[model samples]
Target: MVEGDTFQKFMLDALEIRGEWVRLDDSFAELCQNKNYPESLRKLLAETTAASLLLTGTLKFEGRLSIHARGSGPVSLLMAEATHERAYRSIVNHKAEPFESDDLNHLLGKAQLAITIEPDKGQRYQGIVPLEASNMGDCLVQYFDMSEQLDTFFMFDSDANGCFGLMLQKLPDYRSIQDQDAWDRVTQLANTLSFEEVSGHDNETLTHRLYHEEQVSLFAQEPVRFQCTCSPERSLASLNALGHDEVLDILEHEAKVAIDCQFCGAHYEFDRADVNALFGLGKMH
Candidate 1:
């Protein structure tokens, strides 16, 4: 069992196809460290984390890939984002509840999952897909087919301990559209992955299971990490967006304006002095 925060890509040379796999134990642990989340919520966070990683790996984008879902169920906003630099962050909003077992549809009742790709120098693209897939993997595959018009498969698995994901996509510039036989063969192999096997095994074993029959090459792994880009400076900038009067009013009632990052639960507290300096109300000391 391979254990770490790493991503691997495998390919079948003859088929002109490639697959990406990622295991995110350490990354997910970092996300859950400061937040008090129920087991279900934690698992969802891990699932989204893995999904984001695989999606970013598949799509060659310079800036960021964001997967967000909004639902009327117990959990509301669930999102995970991964950047080209390999940074990751995940968040889930749900009220206090006991540990419970639920499928994706249950946790995300009547929801929509949106995928947004923001490139560094181009216009952003966003795709909205219904929450029809009972699992995150199926939902993402549906997204690719609808949005990109490409046949894509995504397998995402997560538990309280860790998370893992696999993605298979037909090359955009493939030669033959009638070569259903090859696509069927690869997908059939992938379909053999059981929930038990995926949830229980690690990256290496899972890859071996899916592609043992094919001549596949595994690429050098890339490290995945949980990192929050939020900072006091950035938070202060947002406070400025609230305007100077609102900042003073916030300080009037409370000792300080505390802003907590939903992704990492990192708290940024701004006191009156900090506020004054932020608004240029104090001397440059």
Candidate 2:
């Protein structure tokens, strides 16, 4: 009976600040059903998933956005992707350790975070988000500073099963000094909110609690779910990269070419007939 996964957009009507709120519950648990990740890593993955949703709402596009971070520390890689329509999926690659820290330098080491935007009909774009921040949301916030675009702020919280994220970006070029002052005051009020208020309560209650004096236009919530875009046809096309001869060689040693989807844990196997059909190698019997 939980209205588990949803993404909502809202506006501080009087302040010219646009914001988004996202919560992932059943869909989040479904995404992790196949993997056995430690609780800490699971929490990180949940945050990344929520971050991906919030970021996707920030941009106006017809494609998907991917949040990817990699490092040589206890955590090797974490990635999450969400499409424009709100369909999403996420995964993480990490060691099963608790990231024990005798020190900070050894725990998190050198890491890089990149956010990639791939449009459905146009060229793809990627930005490097600073990974030095203490958490995922702050790391993404540094991206706006580096670009010198809109002043963006993010608040994110998550546990092992679910996560929530809020993002607010100032509208370009305030019309008046009052509007400018309002932006500062509004962001200050927002920053004062605790993670529990931001993530635990619904958007309407949370927004009113923070900005009771301002007019808010709360939009309808959109559904977000776990969806993996893997198909056997796509997997078969990947074999083409290896060429016919190589695929035949792989079939020589093994019974069939096997492909396993890491995101959804779906298994795909290509036998001699499947290979022959793909490579135009007529009749491999």
Per-residue lDDT of model 2, residues 112-185, tens digit only: 78889999989999999656777777777788777657778887667666777778888774454366678778
Candidate 1 stretches with Cα past 4 Å from truth are 33-36, 97-101, 175-178, 194-209, 243-245, 272-285
lDDT agreement of model 2 with the native = 0.80
What lDDT tens digits, residue by residue, belong to model 1 across residues 1-285?
Answer: 255787878886667677888887766776677677777777778878888888887667588999999887777788999987667888888755443565778887889998999998899999998998777888888888887777887766666667777788888755564555777789878877876786667666777777777678878788888888899999999999999999899888999899998766789999999988888889856
Worst 10 residues of 1 by lDDT: 94-103
Q: TM-score for each prediction?
A: 0.85, 0.87
**Per-candidate local distance difference test:** 0.80, 0.80
Model 1, residue 192: distance off in Å is: 2.1
Q: Report the Cα lDDT for residue 43, model 2.
A: 72
- By TM-score, the best candidate is 2
Report lDDT (Cα) of residue 58, candidate 2.
69
